[model samples]
Target: MGPGPKVKCPPRLAPCGLRLVQVRFPTGLTSEEYVKQEAWRFARLERCPFHPEGGCGLARHGTYARVSPPGCLIARWWCPTARTSISLLPDFMCSRLTGTLAEVEAVVAAADAAPTREVASEVLRPDVELPGALRWLRRRTRLVHAGLAAAIGLLPGLLARCEPTITSVRSALGAEVALVRLRAELVPHLAALPPPLGFGPRPAQRRSSLTALQQESGTDPPSGTR
Candidate 1:
């Protein structure tokens, strides 16, 4: 069988947007219990007659909750990618700190709401053009060209020896392998060499250290943090 094709990493992050919410539950509850509570709350909301019943309506759904030490439950709700509405629970709770369910319902009724933002077309843009295939072709073409040039430079010797085909093949193969190895070694060494005199931090190392800092902080690291 012929050699399998090589795989390359894609150049961009996936188009999907991830939303994370951090919900704190009372201490001593297990992850399962917190998730159950969230699920129940969501279900209650979904069944409530007050809930809007149409495009982008709210509904309770099961979701994985990350449980941290000392009984912290972070429940995340993902707004649909196309929907951008922010829940007013924060404001509602703050405003109606001491009120009956009916009174709170009045507050919910009184709050004037705004429409959610539309998803940006640019955000869902198509994948980038594939340059990997073109790059590989160029490298191979250069190698072939270099080998041909070297062989032509040696043509006189081969003609003198009356062994044109064999000598040409050997010369080209040797030159190609030598060029490949030289590139393999030289490029990495160049990369490993500290940034040019004034160049800033190495991207990979900087990213790793930043990630370490974020993990230590115990908060969701910045987006694209990883």
Candidate 2:
């Protein structure tokens, strides 16, 4: 019962103590298929996540479903000695945030293609008021842009001197789903950064309800903050 991609952190480093990591698949699998088959049961960890030596009582800890992406269950394990648990999130889904990776990318892509944020909000979220829609669009846009910047710095050779934009990432990686592809490249450092890249701040077992605005804007940092 951590934040479902609805939680936003400040611009500065905010480490949520959650031990969630993504599990990518070799073959192509849609989010729907992943949920329908309960693919998380197939997730494996060769070594103890918390205690990599050999054995530390790391065992399957059951599954938890997310609010978004109906019926999706997160596979998890726990280290009894360490008194901690790790959730193996399927790559098809966005960490911290709700929905699939493609859905997040699509939102950013649509805004990137729009002439202006105002226009993008209108088209992307006509159901909501203009101000709320803009907030929703800006949150995703900022997150994607920030993640891309971090990607450039992380993958110097692959993305050296490249602009931090969706177009640049797509061209550099040669993939349409740039964020998902980028996630694989930055697997080792995923825990250090924010979701889609890393997990953001995790409060001490706190779960707050999302307001109407929060529901519209999945993960918007406070105004005037990152």
Model 2 CA deviation exceeding 4 Å by range? 1-28, 200-226
lDDT of 1 by residue, 1-226 (tens): 1222322212342223443322212223333453445432432233211223323333333332121322222322323422222221211111111212122222222221212111111122124233432232222222233333433344444323322222333354464222222222223232222111001122333554445433322223112210
- Indicate the residue-level lDDT of 211 in model 1: 50
The lDDT per prediction is 0.27, 0.66
Model 2 Cα displacement at 1 (Å)?
Answer: 20
Which residue pairs clash in candidate 2? Answer: 5-96, 5-97, 16-201, 16-202, 194-198, 195-198
Whole-structure CA lDDT of model 1: 0.27
Q: Each model's TM-score, in the order given?
A: 0.21, 0.74
lDDT of 2 by residue, 48-162 (tens): 5545664556677677777668877776665554445666766667776667778988888889988999999999899989978876776667667777887898899999768
Question: In model 1, which regions exceed 4 Å deviation?
Answer: 1-16, 21-54, 69-76, 81-212, 215-226
